[model samples]
Target: MRISVLCDVKPLLGEGPVWDVRAERLWFIDSLGRRIYRCTADGAEMRAWTVPHAIGSMALRDGGGAIVALQDGFHAIDFETGELTHLVDPEPDKPNNRLNDGKVDARGRFLCGSMDTGESDPTGALWRLDPDMSLHRLDDGIICSNGPCWSPDAATLYFADSFTGEISTYDYDIATGAVADRRTFAVLPKDRGGAPDGATVDAEGYVWSACVFDGRIHRFAPDGSVDRVIEMPVCKITSLNFGGPNLETLFVTSMAEPPLPKYPGDGPQRGATFRVEGLGVTGRPEPYFAG
Candidate 1:
């Protein structure tokens, strides 16, 4: 496969990568930078907007604008006016926790997880935001939340708590937006030197995860077997998504600042977005938040 940098702009903490199938564009967030960016399939016509607080993740809305998970809570962002309207805060009492990774399910519900800012406490939890704008807490006692994705049939949900270094799978009820029977799907060995960050599933049902300090992208089969591993040039690879005209390109994101001293050799493209092509597998279009 061919891997190359998609853009020159680097972000402090590049995390979420969302592909807008209908618009043929890619949207990503610079969490620490508090910036949201949009670009075409070719990485041109790039545009950015700065928010007031650090952003965890975001999803395009079905009606218009977008829904963002900021440090404070969920907000509706209007691309035309750049106005951020407060929606709801799932963890209002836990001021130390901030929303992290999020994705829209096939049934049009937005699911996101919160993470403890200190990265030490287990105050985080997984939450679901229905199309009606109501919220529900699915799971709790998480340290660091990341990588929320679903299987091809939408019957399984995979999520990772980076601090735990384990990816868990849950039986997902698409119709009711419920998750149960959580079990270990995969784990990053302690000797691996990194944790699983963000992930996405291909159309063939293979799950792709970005290893943070390990500098690798791992593909896991449906049965939770390691299918393959693709090493990256950057050390702090954060997240990835499938974009491009046919959803054949894997757009990867990374972080540049707060360099990890243990894993050296990070070049100038550390925080720049990268794309992998010719994987011989495409991805399904990500669903937009119906709310």
Candidate 2:
């Protein structure tokens, strides 16, 4: 499958593409530019919200507001009024740390991770929130945490440290918030280039991973094998989703940084959203915090 940019958001980093099923819209974040955006599914009406500071990820809440993992702390973003309310900041004194990637699990609890803002230190971790409003730090010493997506059967969990080039799988016990039997699902091979950015699972139990340097996305099987690859024109493919009526169109998000010279048909394609004709199974909708 050929992946291309379907829409554009200019920033040092663009991340988090969550699909809002109720509103039929796609909400994502431009990390360093300090903005949150809501766009129509067709890549029109791109509206942005200027955060007081940078935000790593944002998702819908069970109540009325949005939950954002910000550089300063975890903020409750009021959807109606656009006000940011502080909720929590686990590491308030760690000025070099910031929240990175996150997603809501099947049980409606938000799972997120953090990494060093300096981009060198490994003082990061994975966190979990219980449905009963309890919180726990799941892991430690992580760098550039990415996807925390669950399998279609809900028995496995996949997470990535973008800087470390490791995607690990765990035997997930959702009821108890426990992960054991850890194994390397895919190493990503740092020598081959590209880090695993944002990732999701299709109904077929394939992990669709976005790449940072290789201008493509990878589809990895449940048994830890490369099933296929989707190439893109832009080098930084940050996030993606399976949207549209049939949920077969793979919606991709990209940035404008090109490692090489621009080609002829590269005007609006770079930093723009792109969709392939036929891809993905009957996939699950991207979840939100709903907390």
Candidate number with greatest TM-score? 1
Per-residue lDDT of candidate 1, residues 84-196 (tens digit): 99989888898888999999999889999999988889999999999899999999999989999999899999999987888899999998999999999998766667899
Put down candidate 2 lDDT per residue, 217-277, tens digits, no spaces: 8889988899988777776677776776666767766665532233222344555666665
Best by lDDT: 1
TM-score of 2: 0.90
The number of clashing residue pairs in each candidate reads 0, 12
What C-alpha RMSD separates each model from the true structure? Answer: 1.5, 3.3
RMSD of 2: 3.3
TM-score of each: 0.97, 0.90
